[model samples]
Target: MKGFSMYIGGISIKNKIFISNILIIVVFISTQSYFANTISQKAIIEKEINNSSRELVLIQNNLQTLVSTIEDYSKILASDYRLQNELYNDLLLNTKHEDSKPVGGLNNLSMKKTLSETISNIVEPNTKIKAVSILTSNHHWVDVGFADNAYASRIFGDGYGPEDRYYLPVWTSLIKFGFLYEGEDSVFAVSKTVIHKDTGKMIGRIFLYVKETTIASIYEEGENKGGDFYIVDSAGRIISSQNKAKLYRDFKEAVSISLPETGKDTTFTQGSGSEEMLIFTHRFEPLKWTIVSAIPMKNISSGRKEINQLILGVGAACLLLALIVSFLLSRSITRHIFQLAKTMRQIRSGQMQVRSPYQSKDEIGYLSEGFNNLMDRMEALMAENVEKQRTKAEIEFKLLQSQVKPHFLYNTVETIISLIKLGLGKQAIQAAQYMANFYKISLSKGDDIIPIGEEMRLTESYLEIQQLRYVEYMEYTMEIDHDIMSYSIPKLTLQPIVENAIYHGLKLKKEKGIIRISGRRNGNQLEIEIYDNGAGMHKNQIKAIMDGTSVPDEINGFGIRSVSNRIRMLYGERYGLQVESEYGVYTKIIVVLPLRYH
Candidate 1:
């Protein structure tokens, strides 16, 4: 403290200030450089981890090819004609005619000699496979023979019932075949019980050795292959590896395979310090093996730490801090602007109730309050406009429906007057009563919706009056399906169509015109058909009626198109009326509507 005081006293005040500024800048630069180096190392490690995953997939493919090669060879050896014939003769055919003289067939010893030659020819070429052991239920050999009927079947695999001849060739597990490859470094043995091709018997077995070094060639592509690769069985045993020392070792630590969130394969990291490894794994389900690529975390970051990058990082940090301070100084003004922008966005998205909650006596505050007041006015106006639209729709629907009623009323009233003039007093009263019931269903307690059953009754009542008026020939039948009797439809829906059929259709026909009304469910809608053997319209007349354009006065007066329009308005555009007619042959008015029950 005394030496520092003397040095400070020696220098001027201006020199002390300049020295302090230099010291501050040096300290800031040094601290920023250390942090920058850490960040860069982490980034490098992340990139390397991604590269390791792609490399792991390549390793998995190579190992799979090796496993597949072993499988293909096994299939070839199992189906060889000479090998199968010799084994079958020794095991099955030779046992039956042991001493019998058949000129083409060989005795057991001669059959064994031929089998050994056949097996050696298949096994010798593939250096990856070290040996072959052929055994039969009646005869057994790694090559030399011993006859034991059920011994070969039970000895190869576990869970073998007396009748079971199948042996699963699970790699890296069998100890019975260990004696066959005594001096050899065997990775696994591919074994399968050979079934007799002709008799369906467990005739023989195929046991072959796959050398351990063959697995090393799968992942170790060249001398410079970077990853430490290995195969781990389900028991945590290291089945095969590039390192010979790790082979057959209990590698319990390598068994913790998991699925990471970011990667595609079943890759997981294990342990934490020097033992920490980024272990990328792929499960080869065909061979029942888990292939792994273990990479050290330290190796990922093994590179020169460049201090030149530190200078650039420190400069960037200083600029960023300056910007942050400037933003903080102006945040009070910008925060309100941001709030106003957010409020306008909410309003634009149809949330009209949202308002800028910031309050102040500045110009911006007045603007925000004005925006909120404008939104309130807009919301109120929208409600009023929606109400007006609903009222207009209801009035239009009532008008379309009321048009049907007046036309029918005029026709019925004229029938009553004509009946009175004809002196049919009782018929006039009955026709008047039917008209009253028809209007009762039409009113439907001041509502437009009525059951389809009631609509049928309305059609019937109108027809009854028409039948009385034209007692000579007018006839009708309601053939509606009972299932849809409870479905609901608009009031006065069917009556207008039936009225149109009578006035324009059946009246013009010379034949006894019959109107058949049939209703059935069509997909999600109810279809009601009004078929009349009457004077049917041509294509142009049907088009005008369907287009809701001008029609012949007799047909147009009933407004069948208006019924279709009412249906579309109530149920949407898909539900309406359709007309199918052939001139002077038939007229079919089909009404399509949504199936509603109330």
Candidate 2:
């Protein structure tokens, strides 16, 4: 232990901390897995046992009720005097009818019709009774139910005799040994002897047929995945089961499970070697049947096996989680050192703007602050020289469109003259004042880039001045977001677009027109849109303006290509103007600039 402690002390502090945490986590996970597996095994087995016992009790009650109901119905038919007389008259009286065919003298057909109605009335109300038949002492029989008459006659053709169970005085308990007609499967039967009250002689037998599924259906309410359910009689013969192939087979295991009539539930593990099964036996005394549920041990233990796998998975995930937590712990301590190294490399490559914003009072923070001061002094010296060169280049770019500015001023002066001549002296003064404000902001000490707020104020002045001359022909609105007012953009960017929209487009249309100016910030760029509802240009005219080949109209001074060129020169090629127009519909011009403050 002393040697291990000395080795950890030799390593860095971050590595020591990471290793210590990993060892603690590994020991905790191992202990948790051991106890969780032991407890899960016991809980799963108890749950399975309880679920099986509940299912067995539920099926037992349902079978007992079904058997009792069928027995009661059979006894009811046996005591009906009208039904007994119908069978007797049909057998004893026969004569010649008007058609010369042999018939009964006492209206035997009427009695047979009455018997048929009684059977329908009795069987229709019960969904379980598949068929009902009356067999006489002389082998003459009639059946009135769902079973085919020919099939029923062939099955019970042998009439009542000493060998038949129906000859006894009492109703027979449900028995599995019976001759089921073709197409009738997994069935059991019960019968009662119909005896004449006056003479104490056997009249006929009342046989009620029911499918064994009537009981198995109750057991099938829940899906029993692990085993097969069997309904077996006291003779150890399987009566009905979910697996139809096992019917009538001898289930010696079921009979031998609860011998000596203990009258209690029995559950045990049966079979040998790896091919073992778990057997559960339950007895129903009224029907003398045993319900055996046999599930292979391999099948029942599958749930326990899944729980074991889940525990192993959790252990592995915890180990991986420990490694991840250790890695993050080490990284947190070294983050500032790595960032300081990267900033020094950037400064070596002559990037002065890459300053570290870290301001801690530690040694690394002092180093970062010293590096930032050195870069700030260097940047101030370089910006003064760079600003002079940029201003000169901008002056050269603006001279290309200088002629348009004088022409615009000339048109505005002529509009004020027209307003005064129309006897609107008050409106003339407002137009002149708006024109002066527009030009004052336009010059802006010859700086090419100005605040967005000042540019927007200039556009409002220009539009209002134009509206005075074309008051009935045009309307205008301005929507500017307050957030982007401090961003810097090129000067006189919007006034040229708005002037063209009013004079060339809206004036050409006979209807009054609408002009809208809107500004908003989109990510790293600012979007200023000039939209107009006027006589828009055709596809060819828009292409010519974008290509800088369109001839300027007499009234319109500035061209769209000039504005697109100046913006692309100030920013990169990514920033420029986009034009969209459809003939006789509308026109929109979008000016894009980088989001920067002067």
Candidate 3:
């Protein structure tokens, strides 16, 4: 009986041991799976945020580039106005000489050759003539290129009726505008007034032909740089395109597409009947035209695929690592270790409230609970440090603000004295009055935010003083949006920008240069830009200004660095000075700030 009882007890003990082992294995597997999933999800979320932020930055850069190109084209077109006016005047001055010609003059050949040579020099190279005719004031037309059978055939067409020749709307418009036709074509024609050179009396028209292809070629050469380019006229018709026929046949359809309402960069997808493309449209205000550049969407996205793949690969590796770690540590002790590790990771990632799972009185559990208490104390200390830093920044900003006004006043008074010595009494008196008004609002009894109008007046006072001192070497202009002038901005915000432009940009130039001060409202933000058409800095100089690494002792333009620091101190790092320069052309400094205090 004793032997049988012992055997039963042994069986019961073995069963209990086997069941405990199995339970431990099950717990380990479940914990491992949870750990792997958490790691993979965290990595994916981080990658997504990083990629999204990078994409936003790239898009913003591209938009700015597009806007800059449009502005450049507008400036180029504006410079062409004088050339167009000159051409118009030349036509009106030559009206009398053609009328003096005899009906069958013997010297007609010599006169035609001389006139052709003179007009050819004025026109651009590679120009072709289709028809040269003299039109009388009474509406009679005389064909000057009668000897050229091809020209006569195209124009006369075996008769003198309108149907015999091509009807040119441009030519008709020119004639109505008091131009004497010298040539006619489907695209453009040239005409001069029919006045005798000696008598200067209106006689008849001297017509010269212009090749439309020549002007089109000029514009094409100017705009082409490997991308698809097209020009849309003021009326929104696709007048010319890199692929002529593709756009020509669908002119009405293309015209109906909405352009960017403002002078902003915009992107659109355009195509029909197997001709799809991505179009980037930039407005050229001076020409009253839109320059559209198109690229294949597939091509642009193909480059992005590699970056996408890289991100995916990194994500996959992290997920695989998490899975392996979770599977390997499936025991109960390992589960506790993983939980503790996760809690530590959360604390490191700034979640201070996280705590380890510990419910036992064993050594491991005691250590975990003690670690959690330590983390709580550390978090409290960190919070105190953050508050201290905030207070310090506020105090430093106030000190900088206090220093700026006194310095500005002393400089203004010195400038006034100099103006008085230069025999400019009335100007000095006016400047002093402006100085008083400027300081009244600038001080505002230590107010941090002041009206933008007050800032503008303060800037104008500084500019006025500088202009007086460097009258022969400097010019200044201001453009402020009326609506935005009432918005408040940081005090002494613009002085450093003006100082930088004059000292760094203009002072280096040998000849007198221009400085432009402009402002505009962008949503809830106020943008103030100071640009100088003077000797610009190199890329290295601009880089040093932005990074704040360049020392003031090394260069004379320390004011730029000061302004940048003050802006950062007041508004945070996101709002500050942005400097851009092209060697020998211009330098621009932009200061961005919120319209109202946060």
Ranking of all predicted structures according to lDDT, beginning with the best and ending with the worst: 2, 1, 3
lDDT of 3: 0.58
Per-residue lDDT tens digits for candidate 2, residues 202-270, read 767877777767767878776554677887777777787887666676767533443335655887776
For residue 511, model 1's alpha carbon misses the true position, in angstroms, by 99
- TM-score, structure 2 vs. true: 0.43
Task: Give candidate 2's whole-model lDDT.
Answer: 0.74
Question: Candidate 1: where is the Cα deviation over 4 Å?
Answer: 1-28, 97-113, 120-127, 142-184, 222-227, 253-275, 304-598
lDDT of each: 0.70, 0.74, 0.58
User: Candidate 3: which stretches are off by over 4 Å?
Assistant: 1-407, 554-559, 569-571, 595-598
Model 1 pairs whose backbones collide? none
- The superposed Cα distance between candidate 1 and the true structure at residue 271, in angstroms, equals 4.1
Error of 1 at 49 (Å): 1.7
State in Å the error of residue 236, model 1.
Answer: 1.9
User: Each candidate's TM vs. the true structure?
Assistant: 0.41, 0.43, 0.38
Model 1 agreement with the true structure over 535-561: per-residue lDDT tens digits? 998998888876756644653443677
Q: lDDT by residue for model 3 over 439-468, one digit each (tens)?
A: 776778878678888889888977886786
Find the candidate with the highest lDDT and give its number: 2
